[model samples]
Target: MASMARNPLPGTIRKDGRRAFYVYLSPPLIRELKKAALDEERPAYELVEEAVEALLKSRRIARPATDGVA
Candidate 1:
């Protein structure tokens, strides 16, 4: 079987140097993130960034000391 080439939908992703992806979140997780973000006075994306950074750290992904430092 041959796969057909298709153009990506606008806002789905980009042809530039940025990549975007999606994750399916359960309601409970969504609520948890919202509460935590509120407590920190930060956006949910900031929490997500911290999570990904922690994950990589746990897996021993090498990173510079200043990688997540402000």
Candidate 2:
């Protein structure tokens, strides 16, 4: 059996100094991220990164609740 391979992107930096990969998003999400960055006077990349981190944290916290919800 073959497994999927991991390819790292050029500009991603992992917290532990390891490799990080980039995933493409839909155009609509890109537009929304641009709008958010403009409104908050922050870079679009920073805003997107913050959003992704928050989502990951939320998922980790919600996993236990989901497991009990059978």
Candidate 3:
């Protein structure tokens, strides 16, 4: 019998201490996002991250480089 690999426990901190959360989007938006992700051959999360960073910059909010620590 082969041993199976173990999955990370819920809420476990991985790279950059990223946490998973849910967001609600309209069906049309979801479709568009999925299509775009497929067309670009990139993960949806990367697109979301870019959009979020742009929004923060536009709002004059500073993004900390290391988990909000100076």
Candidate 4:
């Protein structure tokens, strides 16, 4: 079976030099994200970033880069 960890989406840096990462989500998760973003009146990217940070902090997800090192 293919490992989920190896199924990351391709990402690239934006023209403005901001790093962007892509994550493929299921239809349900996409709907939840859109609803949450709208309810909070914030961009979906911002909510995504917050969720990612929380996950990293809780050790639920491992970041590509370790502290002060990539």
For 1-70, candidate 4 gives per-residue lDDT tens digits of 3564465334545566556566799999999999999999998988988987887777734555567653
> Which stretches of model 3 miss by more than 4 angstroms?
1-16, 61-70
Kindly list the per-residue Cα lDDT of model 1 for residues 1-70, writing each as its tens digit: 1232255456755565345556999999999999999999998877997899898886664654556762
Q: Which ten residues in a row have the lowest lDDT in candidate 1?
A: 1-10
Tell me how far the alpha carbon of residue 43 in candidate 4 is from the true structure, in angstroms, after superposition. Answer: 0.4
2-61, model 3: which lDDT tens digit per residue? Answer: 232245456555577765656999999989998999999998988888899888776655
> Per-model C-alpha lDDT, please?
0.75, 0.72, 0.75, 0.75
Flag clash pairs in model 1: none
lDDT of 3 at 26: 98
Q: Best-fitting candidate, measured by TM-score?
A: 3
Poorest lDDT segment (10 consecutive residues) of candidate 2: 1-10
- For 1-70, candidate 2 gives per-residue lDDT tens digits of 1332344455555675645546798999889988988999998867767877999888877775556652
Which residue pairs overlap in candidate 3's backbone?
Answer: none
Off by over 4 Å in 4: 1-17, 60-70
TM-score against truth, every candidate: 0.58, 0.52, 0.63, 0.58
lDDT of 2: 0.72
